[model samples]
Target: MSEKLTLHKYQSDITGLMIEHKAFGVFAEPGTGKTPTSLYVVNHFRQKTLVIAPIRIAYSVWPPETKKWSDFNNIKTGLLHGLDKEQRFLDDSIGIYIINPEGLVWLESMVAKHKRFPFTNLIVDESAKFKSPSSKRFKALKRVIGLFKRRYILAGNPMPNSYMDLWAQIFLLDRGERLGRTISAYRNRFFTRGGFRGYEYFLRPGAEEEIKDLIKDICIFIKATDHLDLPKLVINDIRFDLPKGLRKKYRVMEKQLFWDLDEGKILASSAAVANSKCQQIAQGFLFESLSDKQKYDKVTKKVYDLHNIKIELLEELVDELNGSPLLVGYWFRPDYDKLKKAFPKAVYFADSSKSEAVQIEKDWNAGKIPLLIGNIASISHGLNLQKAGNHVCFYTMVWNYDMYDQFIKRVLRQGNDNDRVFVHRIIANKTMEEAMIMSMQDKSAMSSGFLNAINLYREKIKEYDE
Candidate 1:
């Protein structure tokens, strides 16, 4: 911790506000240095702090922030994860316990055995992950939250999809005084149920204004673009309809849960698997696993590709990029394999060795890599790839709002002062792609959360069918 940490006015302001409350939240947007700012405030209290963050972030972000600056060194930090890391939990020498959000369920059981919880301060980074009150991790943390003297929550996109996300997150901080004491109480006060199964919830009129005002006292909101001279984030939504033949094939493949093909056929085991094929085909490719491995001397599993329009778009997008590095987020292995073949020099930031990862990061930041292809799950969290280039295109999208939000900020965050980040989404019209895009961007800010977005997406699926 040799370097000094200097906070921007807004960063210091947010920390000051959180410090004033026994329990608080900082809803600062990405690139505003929430890690250091929150840590700076945590350092003042001089007590052990428990940090629960995204798995990748827990592995990379907090521990480095603590070591990079001189003040952070005073706090002993330990990252807890995996069965092999059991020693970290029992080790009393560590003052700051940073654990993956998934690890909380296990930690809860372990710490429950002890007479007292180990840490005094509990900080949830990307607190939006716990927005669902019924989730195992949220319930686990809720059981032990009261044990902490100072509890802080942080997320730039805290309510990424809707203001309703504020409830569970804020509930952990202040016990729902600002939202409601119970999940039902909170939802009932602000939302009216409708849509499919009457389970869909929308905010009552004027709910947004009143809700923000209610929680303003304890939650500090910071928009980085407001405070920093960041280049603009330009999003280009490229919508294309599937070809008539492909569209007909898509409908048939979706309904029958099977595809008749050359030399072999593809079959889906269940409804969920069939639904996934719809998503895959919507993204321009469908994978067919041929069960006839015995034909190849039992050596390899064969796969077939049904269609590919995204690859054509990738070619055009690359030409448009004109040598500027591109970050492509795709969902499946075929997408990865296709992108790798299209751009021979492209680097993938996936499950690579530590040495290979180091070179990938270096080459990307230096602008030597033409394309960096990754799944939304692979290239997110505390990794600073913003220095690479600002041209990011989402070849496909998934359901989680948190992953969608964080993946975009990878190149739009702090170090990207020079480039105007362009986030291009190649969405297939009248398909699940549109539904995924709409749910993520839906302005039902007052009531939408992951569960709400999922319902909204499913409702859109029916609309597409109609």
Candidate 2:
């Protein structure tokens, strides 16, 4: 038989990661081979690897990739997704388990039924899901972390908001040693101002320096732009002029809201004031105050209308692209409506009522539908759509780095034979869209060591001065 399928670069990185027992974060971007790098680390340490990820991703990453890599086609791997089966040997040689975070909701009873072996290593892929301290998934992962001797938190973009790392992620890394034992302690030591209720610590500017120093011996940071053989990525920002009507409405509401506030004519709590600002952004109209029920009712209607606008834009863009199969990335519910209306025949994860999702995949590869749209969180991981479409378009920009990377790789993977893949970003001018683009560029560079890409971004920024 031929030499075992091996990517030496990935193997080298795995060695480094396995040697480090402290909490490690893999900042590798989409298509930079994080899965292989992680797998090799598991193989090197000869430890049981437990992967907690989204359901779709769990199916896409392990069995298929493992078959491609190892000579043993029936290597042992357990999927703890749906029904509980009696404890089974992964393979006589190795044990690998993959479970969706949703499964963790019933994990206590499940573990009781089938005694869980102490997990040697735990890999939390797409770790941004745990950023919210109050979320059930975050708490579930926290409980599961205790069973692992070593842990790895894999994310392309771990730090989005300032408060993210303090509670959820820091707890995973070292359980309060580097950051704090609790969110309150973390805030006390590293944060001081701009938090909720006017006294919380929100942003920690020196956190990066502190993190690197503390994990100096434990963590490894790798950027994709540092790799020589990786294909060059060219990111272009396609901005659309904002509708003049929207701008005028925005200004009229802004002036009226402040005028009312300045004259002491409006009396409301801080939450009411914040809600007014949110209304302006959400619907291009401002309300002095809205009860939670009113806000919820209004938000639902506005989102429905927003979905119409997205479909309109997508139809126009699809026409512009000459009907080439387009891969559309969405984030919100509004996106789903627009996508469904525009491509009635579209195969979507949410449309499970029509046909089974796995069967739909076969239809997709067979070229049944030309246009596909879904949230990046849903479509980005584990799926290969290289045969379906090469043109990727973002219905809206996303903040999470891993989702962005995985979204692009779904079409541009290694076995893909297509030429000249085009990525189109549909952004509304002078909105959060501008900020999202800048943030993604900065974070992508940080993850992938694309020195030239960084230089190009700086040059483009300098153009504004000239």
Candidate 3:
């Protein structure tokens, strides 16, 4: 039998705040029980709610969450995704209709065709995805905002890139009453363009405080550290030097934008492409083609193996763990392939079928899987694996702040049984891997716009003089 649902004091307080405001933003970190707290609000009103989340979360997270807590037993959730979504939409018994952000386009069309919207409340999980005003999902939701009487947005980092991200998300709640009527108005009011080609927007003096004050009534920012007594998180940077021959090749590629391999020439068409290639070399491999075709056409493009230092380091780390479950995050497909080859016992999360993935997750949480490997982009959100492990190793670094943050939270969350969580980062010294880590750290500290963060990252890389 499931245990009785009990809300933490902070959750209860947030619930009250949500109920009182009707339309609000719950900027609570992962594992902070935002889902249950929102469910409590939905149950209190007994209203039909529509939740927008990532596809994985829509299909896996919400329904189980409702069933997990006895307090939410009364809440019925139907996933409106995949081929059977239309059929599922016809079910009137579902109290909460869960759909991915992209599904909003279809939902908007349905509302227009039917000339009515059924949901009384709106809940957007990971609302940061809708931060862009120009995004199709945001536009779709804006068209039907009036259909929902009570609106709420939930996110751990709503402003994942910059404060500019808050405009569209906050617009969904109060229809731009708190921020501005449009993104341009919001930008003009709070920011000035300062970065390269006048593209990056920086906040003006006192704009942060003014903006915070305006949205203070509707937005509640909650940090997990402040509320949850989670275990101590220890981050370890395991640095290694690239092979001398590989090091020379890495510099040539960085300077010339192209490198000649015995098989074919590896090209970096632009700065971004060069950065990606640099990261690949740092991880000990280089792909023949710098095109998207390489991702799919496995037969045509050749992947040259540069070094095995990272794999060797990872094996050592696993040996040190002594058979304990270790969650490993990788970036590129080559990285996953190499990790799997090195540790044959490891299971790749993305390579598994639906049923297999479900079983893998079960085995992982049950402490049955020893080494679970996953692409950070794939498993960054929705799934919970904190029950079985407290140790995470980044086989390769990632540039996206949101993915990196969510990846760590997967293990360091509230349900872990351990008193400490260890995060091991395998970085190549004087390589793009170091630059990527520095970029992530700076972005986390500054919370600047994405492009601006990239520019800052490039400046840091230049200092390396590779």
Candidate 4:
């Protein structure tokens, strides 16, 4: 049996705030015990709760979390997913029903057919998924949200893309009380149309402060660094030059959007296409065909091998680790293919079945796997890999700052036993990879609005105490 779980001071404080407000946003960083904290709120309310989360998290994280903590023994949780989901819903002994965002459509139909909504409390985990007001799932939830007496939305970085992503998420919490009744109203009040063909919206001066103030009363934002003594994060950008011949081909592709290979001539029809091809080439391979219809499968496509500069460096880095478990992050199909070839013992996180994925996570945490590989998008959220090791290598850098940050936190989080976590980025010098890394940095800087709100709330609390 697991030991009794103890809440951190911040977790207890956040729980108090959530219970008081009833409708709230818990924008706490990953691995700071957000799941258990939310579970505490569920236990306190003793109401039937509906949790909408990412598919993997809906199935794997919540149900198991109840069993992991002794305090949660009274909270009976059921996963409303897969073919057995309908049957699971029939079991009324369950106090919490967990489903994915897309499942909301089916759930709405079920509620309509039954002429009743079973749940009185709603929790949307990774609530950023509902950022689009036009999304089918969001629309379905919006229709039925009035039935829930209490609501909560949870995310580490709620606004992953832009401030435009905030309206729908906040609307779910306050039903447009804080932002506006409609997205158009919110946009017209605080933003101006800009960018290509005026498709993008830029915030007006002081709009950010106004928006944050409107939502500050009901939102609780916590950073792990402020509350938890996690391991030191050391990021190293390992730079290298491509071979002379490969370098010439890369430049030709970047300049002309076309390159000649022995297998065939690779043509990039646009700058976006050329940029994508350049990234692949920098990672040591180039796909001969750029057809979107073609899917990556067991059979290898006609890919031309460019150079193994990153792979060779990875081998040296592994040797330097002297057998410590290494988690490698890959972006493209070719990157995974090359890494698996170079390290035959490496386990791919996404290639396994659901049952197999569970065992893989077990073996990984037990230090049974030396080199574990995964795409940033697959292993970025709600999956815990902190017990395995402290070293992470990015064979190719991801352009999205959220994915990159979440993947690194998989090891750098609260449970990590290491004194320092080392993140290695293998960059092909003077290539688009460098540009991507810088772009991610800029995006990271833009995501500080949530942290700013946290600071503002803390100051208000201090003033009240005085």
Alpha-carbon local distance difference test for all models: 0.75, 0.60, 0.82, 0.81
Decreasing lDDT order of the candidates: 3, 4, 1, 2
Compared with the true structure, the alpha-carbon lDDT of candidate 4 equals 0.81
lDDT, candidate 2, 1-466, per-residue tens: 3226656575476557656665677755555667767777776676777788767667666655676576434446777765443343223344677777776666656566656564678888867668887788888777767778888877655654444453577578787777677877766766546423354343366865765676555555565546524334445456554456665554455456445534545432222333244233432222243345754754223321421344556678788877577888876565565567668876576665312544555556666657777778777766667666568888766655556877887776654556556788876554444544665766542212222332343445443321
Model 4 CA deviation exceeding 4 Å by range? 255-274, 290-302, 443-466
Task: Flag the better candidate by TM-score, 1 or 3.
Answer: 3
Name the 10 consecutive residues with the lowest summed lDDT in model 2: 445-454
**Global lDDT of model 2:** 0.60
Q: Supply candidate 2's per-residue lDDT for 169.
A: 73
TM per prediction: 0.79, 0.73, 0.89, 0.88
Q: Please give, for residues 76-141, the per-residue lDDT of candidate 1 as tens digits.
A: 888787665667877888888888888887787777676556788889998988989999998988
Give residue 305's error in model 2 in angstroms. 5.0
lDDT of 3: 0.82
User: What is candidate 3's TM-score against the reference?
Assistant: 0.89
